[model samples]
Target: MQKSIAVVFDSAGTLLHMYRVAKDMSSGDLLTGVESTDLVARRKGRALIVLHTEPSVILAVDRNMRVIDFIDGHDIAIDISCASVPFSVEEAYDIIKDSDIRVDDILQVVGVVRKHCPEIFYVAAGIIVDRNDHSVPYVLSTGGRLFHDSKETVDRLKGLGVSVFIASGDSRRNLKQLAECMGISMERVYDIATTREKARIILELKDTYDKVLMVGDGMNDILALRAADVGIVTLQQGDHRPEKLEMSADVVIRDIREVLGIVESL
Candidate 1:
């Protein structure tokens, strides 16, 4: 059997449920919610139900409220697509501020957003706050029902002398929080800036670890998944359909716990 040293897992969709947080206007508080097909925002106490539409638009519905407001996906995408600084919120803001896009155009977009999404607000604030902090706020939605199982798997892997690390697109701070939740140390979390960077981390670790296993469930994870010795694609909640060439994983599983079994088989 091949000896394995480290196992890398993606944060969202692999260990945590994919959801966004937004400010509820009625209560003036933040709420975590999943995107839904219905055009209504169902709120159970402080929880929320986000209405999702494609071409990639999202509407935040509060407390079972109907159609609070809808944001145009095109408007949101314009800023994101035009952003040259993919990792730096400050750089992204500088580009936006210096751009020729009129202030009116920006306001028009904001006017349509009924719920103030914390992720967007924090990024905007991060640009104005200290750029060194890397303070992109995230809503660490409650872990999925199987999250405890995932944590157990991590514990088991660690007990077997496997080094477990998180290589995720999420910020360092967010990854640290997740690591703490799973009882992993912050040093093991790798805050990923790009898909290629994720792969690079795996390559660098390979220098010492030799046998590395990467478990992921999104298109963003394809590169790192391919770079690892054994890439396992998880079919968990919030998993996106892997693009044609991006599905480069060596194995596929329905549960995260299965990753341990595959590693044991190796």
Candidate 2:
């Protein structure tokens, strides 16, 4: 019998379900819920969904491993189609690293969020400072990360003899940290990878594997998802509809745990 091989995961959604689940999926509803709360993050409350689209388009860790603000969000957006920065990382990073958004604002929002579901504070805040004037407001960047079963999940797949690979837009240093934390080998990971590269890599493994599966949540993972024998998608929103991804996916889920069930049968 031939062994089955799977080219797995697009990251930030499939394996890592970003935007922790929330009862209220809108900005106004999230803020209002927080305003009614007094406590900080609680495991027994509703989750807070992401307010923005992309996370990496915001602050990037420099070659020095320092978190540096990338583009001017005020000029562009944290959306998938990102653009150039008009300001310097030095000037923009200071404002966000030293935020005045009031603990009350965050506490209220996070509190209300926790009241409905379990939430994780993966990132504090991302902002930018003015270039010409230091005191002026620059922009608010985006964020990402998931509250997940980090180590166990990967081990489960590895035990099944899957040659799992991670190709992400994140830096090599960051991916290495995550892979180590997950007990996966850094030698098996690829960082700063583009969408086409993801697809190409999967096809390259086609000669070895009887079957391959690709799972993702972002638009960037579309091509790679389609290239696989099976594809899965994890995001569902009105504006951020998982349509393109759904078309690419053989399986679709609002949750990530559901994937194990679908993949094991294959």
Candidate 3:
């Protein structure tokens, strides 16, 4: 049967109220008052590799050394995904080729990190790469709670027979937990989606669903938002919405709950 409608959601700023912390590789400074998107936007590289592990796990790995040093010393080639403005997996890997990291080492490091920092909900380790020069300047960790309306919105959409999906540049481990919390199946969640991949998801869903709506709050979502049958941008994250991001959406809403009304109108 052809589904009546499908809604694709962006996780971090759209559905989750994220609290992000970044460690400056060069200065050893921890930045608290910043958004991950903001950090990515300010950097010349505009690319991020998201590590799929709990934040505490990453924090527990060699706390004595700097995050960059630990990443440079180990093998992080496994369970890592990239989000870039216009870069591919091969290009992302090429940038970090000299790090001497591989996936097996990352798995072992995550186990050690998890044993120590069990309180953290999410953790990811990835370098911000400048594609032009192939220089990595930073590593970061992020954790956050779901928005108050996230579950309610998901439940309401499902009740109305609209399929819900999550496509974001986050760790698969974190996205799995989020899927469980929101009653969304794992198959519907697309983790570590780059800008182009998000758009592709929307295009693919159009084949099965009569209508598709993409809801997001950041620059990464621009392509998906543009591709959807009805593109919606939410401002509930309370961050500064870039003009280009807002302009891409068919409708701009303040709260996620407004989606219910939009569905009704459709």
Candidate 4:
């Protein structure tokens, strides 16, 4: 088999669509970033900042110069359950927005906490940088597909004498689980991966492969799509929506069936 590849897509709109844990399919957005993946860390850190706090003194500014208490997580009774991380109270508050913690629930929780405990705040030094630090594990990120026919796709690609790999910005655990469910190898799947790194991987593979195709949805898919020889966008209509993703894509399709054809065309 001649070494040739084409067709890459964004996850959410391109591959599979996933619904949030307890929310409707339309609950979340497609633009999640690095901080979004470290949500557990951000949430635990935020909970810790609220420990032992007086709500009245939490410094916060509303529209029109109103220093209303930060009505989000500034109010959770921060006892000691979440006191391990060395992040600050302010950091916690800001971090909440970046985390994948349910927006409606945690925001309401944080707002309620702020109403009661505003004074007790601690600032943990050391911002959590998104760089590939030694502490960061190997990550895989997807655009938005929860379940996929990746096994057939990868197997076909491999049979065609191609090395196939998966990358996603979704939950690493979730991707691992899905790969298992699909009977695809874990070595091929990547979860909770950053957008930049996804593109970097495509570029790295470009060195070895005669051609590489990266696919995705949303803005994060932009870089990888451009990096590949052919960019593909996938979209779904039942509840999960990705209307605008195909605008920047070279070709848009509904399933993985078209992948090999695109490569053949090239």
Best by lDDT: 3
Sorted by TM-score (best first), the order is 3, 1, 2, 4
Residue pairs in candidate 1 whose N, alpha carbon or C atoms collide under 3 angstroms: 41-61, 42-64, 43-63, 43-64
lDDT of 2 by residue, 1-266 (tens): 64687756655544543332222212323322121011111222211111232233322323222222222332332211111222333434454344333223333333443444344323222222333333312122122344365356667778877777787644454466567766777777876555667788778778778887777766657778888888777663212544555787777766555656766776
TM-score of 4: 0.51
lDDT of 1 by residue, 23-92 (tens): 3333434444432111011221111111112212222322222121122322332112111123343343
Clashes of 2: 9
Off by over 4 Å in 4: 4-13, 21-94, 97-151, 237-244
Clashes of each: 4, 9, 10, 43
Model 3 spans > 4 angstroms off = 1-3, 26-28, 64-75, 78-85, 88-121
Per-candidate TM equals 0.58, 0.55, 0.81, 0.51
Residue 93 error for model 2, in Å? 18
Residue 159, candidate 4: C-alpha displacement in angstroms: 2.7
Expressed as tens digits, the lDDT of each residue in 1-266 for candidate 4 is 56655333334434455322111113332222222223323333222221232222332322232111333434433211122233344444444334333323323323433333344121110112122121211111212333356446656766676556667654444456556655557776665445566777778778877888876645556567777777776553233324444565678766766776776675
**Candidate 3 per-residue C-alpha lDDT over 1-266 given as tens digits, one digit per residue, 9 for 90 to 100:** 53499999999878887655555545655565356666677755557776534444554566455434544566444333434456665666666664433333334334443444456455455556557667555555555678889999999999999999999888787889889999999999998887788999999999998999999988889999999999999999786888998999999999999999998888
Distance from true position, residue 57, model 1, in Å?
Answer: 25
Off by over 4 Å in 1: 21-91, 98-146, 238-240, 243-246
